[model samples]
Target: MGRKKNQAMSVAETDREFVLGAAARLFRQKGFDKTTVKEIAEACGMLPGSLHYRYPSKESILVDLMRLALEQASGSLSEAIKGECDPLEQVRLGINAHLELLVGGSDKVYVLLFEWRSLHGASRQEMIDLRDRYELLWSAMLKSLSSQGLIRADVDRDLLRLIGLGALNWVATWFNEDGRYTVKDIGDFVWAVIKDGVIKR
Candidate 1:
């Protein structure tokens, strides 16, 4: 019985992943305002009416996409923090993982960050809450570093968190794998500014 239950859970997980991936790509290419259920269905190679079987509405797809993105970001951060006790190194790893996602999952990250507000009512609020939770993880990590005297005493935790997130968020707009700076280079550069400030040592 337990084995059967586990298999059922695995199948459900796979199905949700498929729906979220399709929605993420469509939303990123077309923007949430422009993307429709029919378009997503076509992208997934399903009939227009078939999407309704998996998602009740286009808004639901947006919500699922945002949720999946957040989940991935959270998992990345959690992995980075594991076995690393140094606050500064943890912060560096967090930023690196975030930029990697922004570069690799650019389309989905773009949609999650920019088009999430298009969801209405409860859906919008739920996505916002999930986003806030993800942001709080970074904020908390920064705050912990400050308390340990690793970060500058004058650095504002909230402002630092915002700058880190804002910097990484823009990667989807301007990042090029062939560009002058690699993803790690960009992540390190942003971290240096956030950690040591622009002023000379």
Candidate 2:
């Protein structure tokens, strides 16, 4: 009986991922406001009613997708900074991880970026909290840099973080997947400007 229950749970988990992946693609292509439950259902090869059993409403699915996107990005950044003590190297690793997250997971990241207005109430706050946690990683790194005299002591930590993350997030808007710069190259360029401008010579 326990084995049967485990198999059932596994199947449900697989179906949920399938629906989320399908919804992410549709949300990116059609815009969250325009994508329909029926379309998502079709994409997942399920009936509309069946899709409802998995996700009660389109908004619910979107909230989960955005949450997942943020979680993945946070995980990427945390992993990139593991065991790194150099503040500048940590910043570089963070930039590279973030750019790679946007490029490699464009579908989910686009949903997170472009569908903010579509979210509301608890779901919106949840995403914000997750985003704040990710930003804190940068906050700590910047603080360390300042304490170590690598960053300008006069710099406002909050504003510095705002500019750094804001500029990095903008990469999703214009970065060309097939263009000259790879993810690491973009990270290098951003870090170069940041390092030269702020780091003590």
Candidate 3:
């Protein structure tokens, strides 16, 4: 009726596995409209009652899944760029960190991206706010470049940020580890696109 007893996994580890593996997989496969809390609990090796004790609704699980994705990704990007003074390098590392998380195939993040629209009411608004907060990381990174005059004055920094992130996030849908381009390479290409317009050199 509860989480397994005396397990080697800590609460945080189990939660990560739940979001990254079992619950994420279930949500990704069946979708929020179709997935049940009972199924999620069973997948995580807990009883349905225990799952309810933790998350009253599937939307709550979705909310936490998204919250964790943003938190972890934001933390990683921030740490990756820490103490690096070059705005260009920060942009490179930040974009690379974002792609690495995406292409690493974290099902938790996948559900966050694909199933965010499934959230509703307070849950939806909560996620939107959290997502925007997370986005400020990227916004600030782009703005840093603009302040240094690395980007053109005529370029709409907000538009570039939105389009650049959209393009990078979509990489998860088609990226392959077995492919020629590593995640870093993809980041490089994307940054190059932003830095240099797609004109023939």
Candidate 4:
């Protein structure tokens, strides 16, 4: 009986993932605001009521998508920088990993990046908390650089992080997966300007 119950739960989980994947494609094609739960149900070939039973609403699916995207992104960067000690190089590695991950999962990242403003109430705050955890990785890197006198001690660390990471984060807006420059090349280009200004001579 336990094994049978586990099989049933696994089937339900698979169905839930299918619904989320279908919604992600639809959300990518249509902006989050333009997407509807019925549209997602149609895409999934499931009854609208069935999809609603799984997600309750389109917004709930969106929040799940965003949360999953950010979690993956954070994990990618953390993995890329593992055992690396040079702060500037860590930032560059992080930037490269983030860009690659964004393009690799562009559909989900697109929804997370552009549809954030559509979220409301607890959903919005929950996403923000996850996002903050991701930003803290950059924050720690910057703080370490400052401790070593690699960057200007007088500059506000928070503002420097804002400007530096802001530039890196915006790559999702214009980066081309098929472009001549690879994601790492783009990261190197951005870091060239970033490192020259901040690294202690």
- Name the top TM-score candidate: 1
- Pairs of residues at least 3 apart in sequence or in different chains that clash in candidate 2: none
Q: What lDDT tens digits, residue by residue, belong to model 1 across residues 43-116?
A: 77899787898788888888888888889889888887889888778888988888888888546677887885
Candidate 2 lDDT, 76-96, residue by residue in tens: 899999999888899888889
Q: List the global CA lDDT of all models.
A: 0.81, 0.87, 0.81, 0.83
Among residues 3 or more apart in sequence or in different chains, the pairs in candidate 3 whose N, CA or C atoms overlap within 3 Å are none
Backbone clash count for every predicted candidate, in the order shown: 0, 0, 0, 0
Q: Which ten residues in a row have the lowest lDDT in candidate 4?
A: 101-110
lDDT of 4: 0.83
In the predicted model 4, the residue pairs found to clash are none
Worst 10-residue lDDT window for candidate 1 reads 192-201
Q: How close is candidate 3 to the true structure, as a TM-score?
A: 0.86
State each model's C-alpha RMSD to the native: 2.3, 2.3, 4.9, 2.8
For 76-128, candidate 4 gives per-residue lDDT tens digits of 88999999998878978887887787667567777888888889999999999
| TM-score of candidate 2 relative to the true fold | 0.89
Over 4 Å off in model 3, which ranges? Answer: 1-20, 198-201
User: How much lDDT does candidate 3 score?
Assistant: 0.81
**lDDT score at residue 192, model 4, on the 0-100 scale:** 87
- Measured against the true structure, the TM-scores of the candidates, in listed sequence, are 0.90, 0.89, 0.86, 0.86
TM-score of predicted structure 1: 0.90
